[model samples]
Target: MCRTSILPSTVKAVKRGEAGSAGELRGDFDLSGDLGPLYANTGSGIFGRLEEAPRAGAAVPVGMALPGPATILANVRGDEVREYDIEILKVAPSSADGRDLVLSVTDPELLEETGGIVQGMSGSPILQNGKLVGAVTHVLLNNPEKGYGILIDHMLEAAGDGVD
Candidate 1:
């Protein structure tokens, strides 16, 4: 299990009714510099068609195990930011076959606001002992309040030109 904190500058909000579809959320952060070039191919030739289509019914994996008491500072009703304690119930890895970080939350308030996962919260950099660990990804459809995260090391590695 991994524990991390949220960076202030990383916090963003999606206007109540303006969040787009899931695909939009995944691409919310500009990961080009971090993950290298993402490609899209439509040609029929072998090399030209290297980009594989996203799985039709596959779920992105979350990683690690559920963490113990985590603190959530979220805007509750009346625009008041409230803090709550959370426990990670589970974690899955990212779906990219790369080192992605994802996890499940056990906090009710956060679950409600994010419906497990929401936009504007995608790039919330998670920290542990002041060290970045990951960023929020998406919410699990079956459990709307549970979300995914991308491991910080993976993000750093991707961003660092793949240096160890």
Candidate 2:
């Protein structure tokens, strides 16, 4: 599908509390440009393959470790990118999805900002030591202050068609 992308902006646009209506499509996407070809669309995340040669910059190579300081960029309610400081608590090679890195939200202002991670936050890129390690994939339902991140390397390898 050329015009296929299941973005948070599109998903959030669905109107709720309607009669005899699954949802409504009215709001425009917050993306600067279209999201390319979409391969997998799930409730948890979307897997899309970029349809281009290759672009330089923006994405950093996946880092090997995550034990120190890191930063996360996430869009909580719309297109507003918010930065939060965090510290890697632990890393496990085997998780629910094979490998997952645990993170502790150390940003002093995060809780007061949005009551910790809210909806539509998974897949937020996680940068450690100025390198892209992975993304915030899941947050503990009981404890919102902590979350799980999937290594970028692991994701690229899983793509099969290679990363763009």
Candidate 3:
């Protein structure tokens, strides 16, 4: 689960629906998960065992994250997941609260469509060099184009799933 105040007993994720812009909800999902405290919930992200796991992707060390070209997989509108271009502006490997990747949205289509980063885009995968590096965590309210991301390493560490 992404960072949110309300943790309901059940979470209904988006599966299929019409696309939407900022401040609007889109998509639909029949898949739902039952909440339990056994899951690892931390400042970085939430991790839990699913009945059927999704295929695992290549993982990259967070230390490799730098100021360079990258892409974020996000479902900003409807159920269509698209890869949006982004620039890794800065990296804080030592960040304690998961604000490791400082990035900006540069994709013209994403910028024009959703007006940069908006709500419900958190936990979007940040991929670089064909590897998973981090996840979008928060967006700059004053400048939606800018935002912070949590390093995948940090998330894995928080979940006690791996070690350096």
Candidate 4:
């Protein structure tokens, strides 16, 4: 029963237009005692059930910790996946209703280039300790230098059901 909130409107849209898909709604059934695949993608927890499973690519494992040094892969300029250094300012545990990870863009070059997190970089992969921890889900417009990230576990759980 994975769920998430505190997402920007852009990040919460049903881009896939599939059933059981919502802006912030993802699935994660990988927890102990759970028997089904989860439908995840939003900024939440582990995998869940779904139909069209995405091709499992190189992502960090589920249940990874946060509030550490990290890197994010974002296609900010054209098709190139550029890397940016960041810091996980905070980790909003499940009790925080899926607040997930807060971030501070520490890459001076990226700031000079993009001016901060953009609208289209919502799905950018956040890597900590060389592991895929989550994705960029929101931006603090008042302070573009700061933003939020969703746990990679939630993505795994959502894609777990076999959907992209």
- In terms of TM-score, which candidate is strongest? 3
What is each predicted model's overall lDDT from 0 to 1?
0.41, 0.63, 0.70, 0.61
- By lDDT, who's the top model here? 3
- State in Å the error of residue 51, model 1: 35
> Which ranges in model 4 have alpha carbons more than 4 Å from their true place?
1-63, 95-98
lDDT of 3 by residue, 12-115 (tens): 24322122423323444433543323466679886665444344544444545778999999876544678999999999988767689898999998777766
What TM-score quantifies how close candidate 4 is to the native fold?
0.61
Model 1 shows how many backbone clashes?
16
Q: Which parts of model 1 are misplaced by more than 4 Å? A: 1-66, 71-86, 90-99, 128-130, 161-164
Please write out the lDDT profile of model 4 over residues 59-79, one tens digit for every residue. Answer: 345448577788888755433
Candidate 1 per-residue lDDT, tens place, 1-164, comes to 43222111222343321234331122133323231222221111001121344334343333333344443434434434444444444344445632254455566656545544555445444443323445655555555455566665455445443222
lDDT for model 1: 0.41
Candidate 3 CA-lDDT value: 0.70
Deviation (Å) of 99 in candidate 2:
5.6
Off by over 4 Å in 3: 1-38, 53-63, 161-164
Which runs of model 2 end up more than 4 angstroms from their true locations?
A: 1-3, 6-33, 41-45, 50-57
Superposition error at 89 for model 4 (Å): 0.5
Candidate 2 Cα deviation (angstroms), residue 147: 1.3
What is the per-residue lDDT of model 2 for residues 1-164, given as tens digits with 9 covering 90 to 100?
24776443533332321222222223346566654667765433467866553344465667775688888986543455667987878877556562378887788776545445444556888888778887777666566666688877666666655345
